[model samples]
Target: MPACEITIEKIDFEEPIHIVRITGALDAYSFPDFEIKVRDIFEKSGRNIILDFGKLDYISSAGLGALMGFAKIARQNNGDLIILKPTPKIGSIIDVLGLSKFIKVFWDEKTALNSFVSKAG
Candidate 1:
């Protein structure tokens, strides 16, 4: 089995949104690490954030909880947290949980980023 690992890749976008691309399995074992990175991002800069999950392999309930937590924090800061390129598995979970009503999921980074820009402007 592959060891659970989560990596945050920074993206350079023209808008004021901060894109954090997360790649790897986001399981219970990796939730803490994931939370730390997400918390830091929200704490340091309250920017409209897009979480690109194109390369993410897996995610558990704990991982979803982390995302929800970040979403709540982002909302409190008057920012939004969106997901980009989530695998079908992850997308389905979000859909089932009714989170799709709160967060929008996009197929690509550009669309996700554009939505943020549109909302901000």
Candidate 2:
């Protein structure tokens, strides 16, 4: 049997932005863990964020709820959240939910990260 695992990690950027890379399934069982980790990081930094979904395999409604919660928190702090490298399946899910209207999606990390600078005052 294969070892089942889900992982999330935070990588700090230069300033006012951070990347949260998530991998594996993000269903109800794992959403809370991902939510907690992300919330804790945001509570401390409260900066712009990039959610890197390059390696993420799946997500359920609970996972989407968790992401919405984090988006609210980011917005409350005047920070923005973007997503990067989502697979077509995930991208379609996001589109169906109309989340793409509120959250920007990028095909590359550099472009996603650069948006903050270009849009800055």
Top model number, lDDT: 2
Residue 89 error, candidate 2, Å: 0.4
| Model 2 worst lDDT window (10 residues) | 1-10
lDDT on C-alpha atoms for all candidate structures? 0.76, 0.77
In the range 1-121, model 1's lDDT, one tens digit per residue, is 3455555555555545677766677776777777787787777785578888888888887678667778888888888899998889888888999888877799987787778667767
Residue 35 of model 2, lDDT score? 73
Question: Candidate 2 — which residues are off by over 4 angstroms?
Answer: 1-14
TM-score of each candidate structure, all chains considered together: 0.85, 0.84
RMSD of each: 2.0, 2.6
lDDT of 2 at 20: 77
Off by over 4 Å in 1: 4-15
Pairs with backbone N, CA or C atoms under 3 Å apart (clashes), candidate 2: none
Which predicted model would earn the best TM-score? 1
lDDT of 1 at 39: 82
